[model samples]
Target: MSLEIRSLEIRIAASTDADAACTVLRRSITECCDLDHKNDPAILDAWLGNKTPQMVANWFNSPTNFSLVAVSEGVVVGVALLTGAGKLALCYLLPEARGQGVGKALLARMEEQACSWGVKALQLHSTATGQEFFARRGYVDAGKVRSPYGVETVFFWKQLDAGAEAPDGGKRKRFCNCNPV
Candidate 1:
């Protein structure tokens, strides 16, 4: 039977999810990006070529940072994180789950957290492939940026309204993939 795409339940990740989130992240790097696990034998041998579990932990451990996990039918398929600098820490989806609005949901949640934290702008170092995605969502290009691995990453940022504070009574309603036009 085909799985019907429904609204994913997003919540603050627990400590147990730390490891799973790592796996999802590294795997996404291999699957989503064209970089091959076989290419550059030396690079493959090294750990933390781009992302690592410890990095994710450090991100989650930040006081002003917020990470959310997207679960549908009890399976975690997507992860996202927003930093105090308004940086988009980590946003990924399983290859099978792409284009089903899962990324939209994840991004919406990230924006929601940003608004709650009183963030004025959202910044990100995105891949060339991800530039269009961010651009479509109102993010403007800042310039070329280099990642730790020496890959050229594009910098993008989006302005947010300062008036919207975190909904004290009900925060979940603010995370409905409802982008302002």
Candidate 2:
């Protein structure tokens, strides 16, 4: 299903969104990231083993992390998490949401959050399938690293502009009222 990018609602993920966010994480890994896992049972299991709803809720509630979800027609289509230490820990989109700009929206928000937190640069370990996406967004390829799941992962980093502001000139709609400590 093709979705209009403007129609997606990107907001801070809440505990209530854990189940849907977990589903997005798992499905995106198992279905969309075939090249990284190669349908290997062991790899898939290891990668998805801890992606449970409870874990997602814990991530959402973490003071050191900023988590966001993209919703389309009341359904969560994508999820992303950014750490206080400048790590883009998670960014995944539902299979049908790929190439629909949802990922870009989630990423932009994460960058904004990073800037707000005084992060100088953002980094992430990208799967083979996500390398190009990060690259196109100006993330530089640092090198390759072996993932815990025994997969080759690309390391990407992007320097955040110190003066960066939201696209709306700091008037961006506030979806989540919680303040990041």
Best by lDDT: 2
Stretches of model 1 off by over 4 angstroms after superposition: 1-4, 35-55, 162-181
Q: Per-residue lDDT for 62-164 in model 2, tens only?
A: 9998999999989999999998899999999999899988999999899888877867678999999999999998888999999998789999987675444
Q: Candidate 2 has which clashing residue pairs, if any? A: none
Candidate 1 accuracy as lDDT: 0.71
- Measured by TM-score, the strongest candidate is 2
Worst 10 residues of 1 by lDDT: 169-178
For each candidate in the order shown, give its overall lDDT on alpha carbons: 0.71, 0.88
lDDT for model 2, on a 0 to 1 scale? 0.88
- Each candidate structure's TM-score, on Cα atoms with residue i matched to residue i, is 0.77, 0.87
Candidate 2, residue 112: the lDDT equals 82
